[model samples]
Target: MNMNKREKIYLIAIIVLLGLLLAKSFYLDEYKPVTEDEILFREYVEKVIDDKFHGFFSRSKLIGYRIVSIKKVEDEGVSVIEVKSENEGEYKNAEIDGKYVAKIRKYLFHVLPYGEDKILSRK
Candidate 1:
């Protein structure tokens, strides 16, 4: 079929628009809410490590104190932390410091996108 000039132009425009929209959807990865639990869990790991390095962690002598577990808890404020201890079995009640929590927030929004893991990389 022979098409008019205007019709051909319109068809091209529609194709371009659809391609752009498709690319954007793939880039966005949908609306994923990280939730308070995920944030809290990440903060817990950073805090626990900080404490251990500063000599404030008492459970250092435990078996699994070196292993950091970051995950959202089923029933609790945000997420919970569980550290494996040698003789003590598992260490609980891992607390996150205010500074470390802020650091995690920065990392998630800014740093992770660029494949940077540093806390200040978000800037």
Candidate 2:
């Protein structure tokens, strides 16, 4: 069946709107409520990362710390989390200070450092 000119225009407009909505869902961050289990997990993970950060920088003081994001590892019972932090300290004669980022893996109740800490800034 041949659609009228106006009908064709409307169809195209509707499709474009639908496409935009789908793209937005993938590109934007949707609001997700914090759940009880997620809260507990985050608190536990934060403590684990905090200890590791301090241990890695013995004389450093962590000024700020946060978990950037958490993602599940395939079908496993493990999660990979990204952490961002800022700290300052003195080592030898030089001052160590910077913003840092790290990824860690959590399985059950155990947490493991995943990779090297990335220094975002230092002077």
Candidate 3:
């Protein structure tokens, strides 16, 4: 191994600085963006489907809500967002005891540290 010209330019500048630090850590973990409590819990679940169907379905039906699973207990600070909306016929397993509030009439939307106020519960 005759690595000579300044040890092959310092081993090709340490293999191109370790391939640009593994492509900037996989492009900052796959282009991460979209957090502010996930855009305020997706605009508070589209105002909980426009205050649970007051707009009377002409369009924008929660844009077909589907978030199969999300979990963050964080020592019971709470965050368990599992959602699915088969066109807002909500297939049961419901529980929303405390926080997670969303209303449209007077514009109330809450998303913080989660633990139920109806965020799609079924199993």
Candidate 4:
């Protein structure tokens, strides 16, 4: 290809501008503001726990459950919520010293923010 000085300068400017644009896009995307809905998050966690332990535990036992912390993690461009909960209760067949003992049970849950109905893990 035949090019003059003006053409060469224009081409260089275009390349530099494109590079800057690309960099700006990446920077903006990386720091994009994320929306966190506390109510929705809590509701989702409760619904998940209820659905999983519905007939397994008495209502009284589950009533003591409370969320300890909720954190948002970004992995592979996906928004994941990590929830930690603690409850003081006695489960069926769980006895210590020949008697049911009240103990703290920790629960961990991983949820996807894309859809509140999607739960990644529960422990």
Instruction: Provide TM-scores for the models.
Output: 0.28, 0.29, 0.23, 0.30
- Report the C-alpha displacement of residue 11, candidate 4, in angstroms: 85
Per-residue C-alpha lDDT of model 1 across residues 1-123, encoded as one tens digit per residue:
999999999999999987775554344422232655445445445555455444422234311122112322233232235444355545555433222222222112211222212231011
lDDT (tens digit, per residue) of candidate 3 on 3-105: 7799899999999987775564334322222445444444446555556646533243422222322332232233444344456745322223223322122
Number of clashes recorded per candidate: 4, 0, 2, 0
Q: Which stretches of candidate 2 lie over 4 Å from their true place?
A: 1-33, 56-59, 74-123
Q: Which is the better candidate, 2 or 4, if ranked by TM-score?
A: 4
Model 2, range 89-112, lDDT digits (tens) per residue? 321221122222223432211122
Leading candidate by TM-score:
4
Query: Which ranges in model 1 have alpha carbons more than 4 Å from their true place?
Result: 29-123
From the highest TM-score down, the ranking of the candidates is 4, 2, 1, 3
Q: Which residue pairs of candidate 1 clash?
A: 62-86, 63-85, 63-86, 64-84
**Residue 103 accuracy (lDDT) in model 4:** 17
Query: Candidate 3 — which residues are off by over 4 angstroms?
Result: 1-35, 38-40, 54-76, 83-99, 106-123
User: What range of 10 consecutive residues in model 2 has the weakest lDDT sum?
Assistant: 90-99
Better of 1 and 4 by TM-score: 4
The 10-residue segment with the lowest total lDDT in model 4 = 94-103
